[model samples]
Target: MSQTATILVIDDEPQIRKFLRISLSSQGYKVLEAATAGEGLSQAALNKPDLVVLDLGLPDMDGQQALAELREWSQVPVLVLSVRAGEADKVLALDGGANDYVTKPFGIQEFLARLRALLRQAPAGEAAPALVQVGQLRIDLALRRVSLGDAEVALTRKEYAVLAQLARHPGRVITQQQLLKDVWGPSHVDDSHYLRIVVAHLRQKLADEPAAPRYIVTEAGVGYRLMG
Candidate 1:
């Protein structure tokens, strides 16, 4: 089913577009291409592609603007492609509605892996399950509630967002910058301490032993993963 997913690749660079078109098409995906943001949006609306590959630098419109505009009308997942590798740029793209960001000169293998993960976590058309049981913790995404065994757990907005993000991916190691951007917005991307604090709070709430958490495992300087 993943191989059959359609993707729209939007970039001003003909070479990049050609490369991705061939690469993705060879993998069994129906690839659509557009040279500008306007065309991309038009194609998206018309085709309703399963995923979008958007370039940040567009001649007619900024990539962030396009993401925001598309998000206003559709919840289709968007993956940003940009020359800018700055944490700030990544944060802005993610905060503006991009599901993921990849800098230029990216390895094809890494890019493909990221694409797969993003698609795997794409929201389903039908309603999601109200109760999500992962390991020893139970989460009610609809009600924004959590429980550990028989005890009700309390979590802050940020903590819940972090936990939910991890829950969405299960074993995936979500980067610190990505979590920061997704949970705290673009402005707080540089503040790694914020993630630490929130993660600690979440562990305290969900883990029997905060120091040796079973569900929320830290990946040192990398990120956090939810071990199911």
Candidate 2:
């Protein structure tokens, strides 16, 4: 998915744009930069990025105005970033069609996580199977249930979220950051210990051993992939 996920960074600050570009590039997302509101709008229309990281304080115009104008034609996901931490400002951005609001002084992990969340799955419309079969485990995405060889696996919400995400993409390698962000939220992406703990618990429930994994296989210093 990252091979071509272009993210537009709309901010007046060159440093912010550089920071985002570097961070996002490391995560394999293609980065596009715009320093002003008009440039952002023009870039959005011209490039049609997969996701947008927009700042509320643009030099030429307010970010909300750009967002509103954007809403008139596109439904692309926008993560509004601003120094304005006021609730009213957040509400205004959200109401104007922004998908999410992140205040300035945000953690890079969290910011990346929000972007991952926005681009996590395709617009949810395609019908998936009611039950997914992975080895002895059967996942019912609809009923919110998972059964392993006729024994229902009782899992916490976080556990289930992680498993379901991996199950949905059987052979794909989900990055540690992606899984962490998806399961534990953005702020927890860099907390590898937390992910390890959860994965350990999940493996225990699934009767899986890390050394000879039949279910979730650790990709060593990278991420995890459910054996297909």
Worst 10 residues of 2 by lDDT: 122-131
Our tally of clashes for model 1 stands at 0
lDDT of 2 by residue, 92-210 (tens): 99999999999999999998888888887536443334357878988765445889998999999888888877876777899999999977899988999988888999999999999
Misplaced by over 4 Å in model 1 are 126-228
Decoy 1 TM-score against native = 0.55
Please provide TM-scores, in order, for all candidate models, with all chains considered together. 0.55, 0.53
What would you estimate as the lDDT of candidate 1? 0.83
125 Cα displacement, candidate 2 (Å): 9.8
Q: Which candidate achieves the best TM-score against the true structure?
A: 1
Give the total clashing residue pairs for model 2: 0
